[model samples]
Target: MKIVITGGAGFIGSNLARALTEQPRVTQIRVLDNLSTGHKPNIAGLDVDFFEGDIQNAVLLDQVLRDADAVVHLAALPSVPRSLRDPLASHHANTTGTLQVLDAARRAGDLYVIAASSSSVYGANPNLPKHEDLTPAPMSPYAATKLATEAYLSAYHHSFGLPVLSFRLFNVYGPGQRADHAYAAVIPKWVSATLAGQPVTVHGDGTQTRDFTYVGTVCRVFTNALLRRIIEPRPVNLAFGTRKSLLDLIPEIEVATGRPAHREHRVPRVGDVSHSQADSTRLLALFPEVTPVPINEGIAATVDWFRASAVIAASS
Candidate 1:
């Protein structure tokens, strides 16, 4: 299979690239990344035709989409806090960029497009285990853009017969997650802080919960989504189908790192959801064989990677 992964240099995209490279059926893998938030080192040594560019570029999107059997669209400005700071930038990247991918795929014809949507689309709804059918009440600009993109995908599928699917990803984390950034996910941020003997900031008494899906599981689901055919462009939740409170996760992180975290409690920031979990019934109906890596196991792997990276940094 000939495939192109947009934002392929980013955390999840880079992991997906490596996974696809190991697959015997995948003949070619092309990557397009703007490197805005993606690191150059992420895609290093990977067997891929890498293109450094933005997905908003029509010519670039057209060039990359040509002859590709499928395009896993993972490009976006992802972060609720950052989105709150600058909604326009997030909209341009998440919303406009997604539309460009859909349009390019439509023009390309015969190419399947699977996009990365966020569970944040559900916003702060008090509902537990959010289903795909839930009315999305996006609180942040980032969530709003993701919700809009999903709408575009569904519209394109119905109006133009475009083969498309959108995965409403939960809190994905694992190795390769950037910890040097201000917008890093909680797992990587806390892991880094714990390892460095710094105080890990816990927002809102650390009681807020999230369906912390590991990156490997996410990649596996994305690969499956590529090979499978679902006629509807309905956004399916891709997660471990389990939720963990931030407080609950800290102990596991401490165990993984063999150290205690100096935690500083603070009020939760604006746009932060109190609780989030996924109802994976829609996903399981399609990929029943999918099994999630236990959160403890994933924590161990992530902590080990960060420790090893720190060692490498110290040596250099």
Candidate 2:
């Protein structure tokens, strides 16, 4: 079986591609990406077909989707701040790009399209352990686009018989992640700070909690979602089901890097949620056997990878 994974060189996409490469049934893994935020080094030495192009380009996206049995769409402009800065770009990439991907895959007669989603769709509802049933209150353009993408996936599934499964990922973090962007995810940024003996920026007193899921764990969930014969439109929450606050997680970072973080409390960014977790009961129900790897184990592995990858590690 052949598979096409968009954003295939990004952190989550690279992990998913590697997983598919090892699968006995998967003979070909085609990676379609623009390499905008994705580094070519991410997929280096991996045995797969890499196509460099934007998902918005229908002709290119169509070519990539043709002959692939499944499509895991992960390309997007991810970040609340970044989305706020360029709402139109975010919407175009997340919403319109998704439609194009699904259209391309549908034209190719592929039934499975596992689209990556975000927990930001929950917004600031003060809801604990967010369930798939919760009404989405997307606060930022990024979240709204994701929610829009989810809507399109559902519509395609029902109207055109496009088998699409949306996996709502919460706080995914791990190795090979980008830490250079202004709106980069917390894990990579914090790890970079702690490693450099710099103050870690904790927005909103660090009380904000999140389901900091390991990227490897999320990659597994994506694989499971791809392998499954999804018959209808079902948006599943892919998370660890455990919660961790930024304050409580600092000690773990310090322990991992052997350097305590000097935290700087900053004003909460707009469109940010106070606390959020996932009620992964429904997800576990679907895949009863798949258990998320412990957060600490993931953190340790991430820190070790950073230490190995960072050029200044020796000098530090």
Candidate 3:
């Protein structure tokens, strides 16, 4: 099987690339990234082809899609805070970029395109255990773009017979996540600050909750989705099927590093949701073996990686 992963140097993509290398049926794995936000070090020394280009480039997208049996579309400007900074940049990467990849897949052949959606698509809906049947009410341009992509996916599937599956990933955390960026995910930012012996910043009083799933578990879902010939009646949620508030997370980090989190509370950023918990019933139907590591266990492993590799921790 030939696979092409966009943003292959990013946190999820790099790890997916390395894991795919071990699969016996995989003939070649190509990474198409512009390196705007993705790191080169993530894919260094890996046995994979790396194509550094924008996904919006029609020729390059077509070239890569031609021979690919499947595409893992992971490239995007994926942050609510960052999207608020420049909505136009976010739209191009998240929406237009995704459309381009879908188009390329259509032109090349009938290939399975597994798009990387986000939990933010659920928006500010107060309902717990978000299910796919709920109408999406996106709060920000970032969330809006993801929702739009999901809608577009169904159109492609119905009209062109493209086998597209959307995985709305919750707060995915493990290694290689960027810290110190204008839009850092809460886990990496907290980890970076606590590891540096600095006070961790808590926006909105540390009450926000998320279903933080490990990256490895998410990767396994992608591989499982590829192997299955039929996917079902709804888009799937890839999460731990549970929730933990930021208040709940702080203690876990404290235990991981053996230091208390000195937290500083501030007003919550605009477009940040109060909570997100996904129902992974659909995810399990596709891959029953995909059990998530406990949130604390995932956090402990992430902290150990940051602590053991000074360069990785410092670079981010």
**TM-score versus the correct structure, for each prediction:** 0.98, 0.96, 0.96
- For all candidates, the clash counts are 0, 0, 0
Answer with 1 or 2, whichever has the higher TM-score: 1
Candidates' C-alpha lDDT: 0.91, 0.86, 0.86
lDDT of 3 at 310: 77
C-alpha positional error of residue 314 in candidate 1 after TM-score superposition, expressed in Å = 2.8
| Candidate 2 off by > 4 Å | 311-316
Question: Mind giving the per-residue lDDT tens digits that candidate 2 earns over 15-40?
Answer: 88888887888889999889877877
Best lDDT goes to which candidate? Answer: 1
Clashes of 3: 0
Residue-wise C-alpha lDDT for candidate 3, range 221-256, written one tens digit per residue? 787776664444257899966799999899999999
Clashing pairs in 3: none
lDDT (0-100) at residue 305 of candidate 1? 88
